[model samples]
Target: MPLILFNKPFQVLCQFSPQEGRESLADYLAIPNIYPAGRLDADSEGLMLLTDDGKLQHKIAHPDHKEAKTYLVQVDGVVDAAALARLQAPLDLGDFVTKPCKAVQIAEPAWLWPRNPPIRARADKPTSWIAITLEEGKNRQVRRMTAAVGLPTLRLMRSSIGAFSLATHPLMPGEFVEVEAEALRVGG
Candidate 1:
């Protein structure tokens, strides 16, 4: 079995199968028989784990395991204590209620690479950075959470999953590395 860590860039589709005009995993990764353990939408960027093991993938992606996934987000507003507090609470988000999660305002990470097409810059509109850790992965949950708190997400990055962190394993966008598969217990 092979385990891979890939730094997926913005605008690249999460799937390996080719899509019209958009770049997909195949454009970056060549190793066969491997699939992403979890998915980050094309708009989001950062660390992703891929493996050939089905059980390992389920453990990583399934909400049942509650493996922590942290996101470093850039929101459109100047985040305040109130906004952070709201994010940490189990506020309703229409279709479903989110689980309580950790949300804190943070300084922009020095390790961050500029997006291919940088986020919009406005002299009067200041942006804020936040680090949020959630056990359940919902579609556009981080973005929606920030928006509900009045801080629309300008950029979102999945920096870590469980013990693996992009901060420790820095790879430029579109780069990937193969690693040991023993990191997960799938034999049970």
Candidate 2:
């Protein structure tokens, strides 16, 4: 089976099922029988994988496989080394302690498309970007992590998972490309 790499837009629901007035995967993809292997929250935007292959979907989305997921996070602060260090070191998130992960301050990516409605802008406050990679992507982990360090997340975008990446396969919102399942570092 083939894999669909979709760049989901902000506010789009992650599932195909209808949800009141909001748009869902069904609106963007016409491919039948394929379902999202993983998901992004309705408020976040980034790369999402959809496939009909059950085992492949499990490897990619299940936490036990330990596939790395990297996020380009825009936080509500002038990000500092202290925050980066805190992100790298695992601070307990109440429910779980994250395994140590790579975190670094980064310039806002030039390749990124501007969000449609856009995040709030305030003259009194500033924002910064950081790249954080973690193997486990539980519910709102990145946002909760940033908030734990006093740097609330303003925008979140997943740039890569395992071997597939946006750097190699740049996609605008609502676009998708099919790739050979074997080409993925995971499996068919």
- When summed lDDT is taken over every stretch of 10 residues in candidate 1, the lowest stretch is 179-188
Give one digit per residue, the lDDT tens place, for model 2 in 22-140. 99999999999898888899999999989998788888888877879899999998988898898999789999997889999999999999998999999999999999999888899
For candidate 1, give the lDDT of residue 8: 95
Error of 1 at 33 (Å): 1.2
The TM-score of predicted model 2 comes to 0.96
Mind giving the per-residue lDDT tens digits that candidate 1 earns over 26-126? 99988887899999999999989999888888777888777788999999989999998999999799998899999999999998999989999999999
Which ranges in model 1 have alpha carbons more than 4 Å from their true place? 184-187
> What is candidate 1's CA lDDT for residue 167?
79
In model 2, the clashing pairs are none
Candidate 2: Cα lDDT at 144: 95
TM-score versus the correct structure, for each prediction: 0.96, 0.96
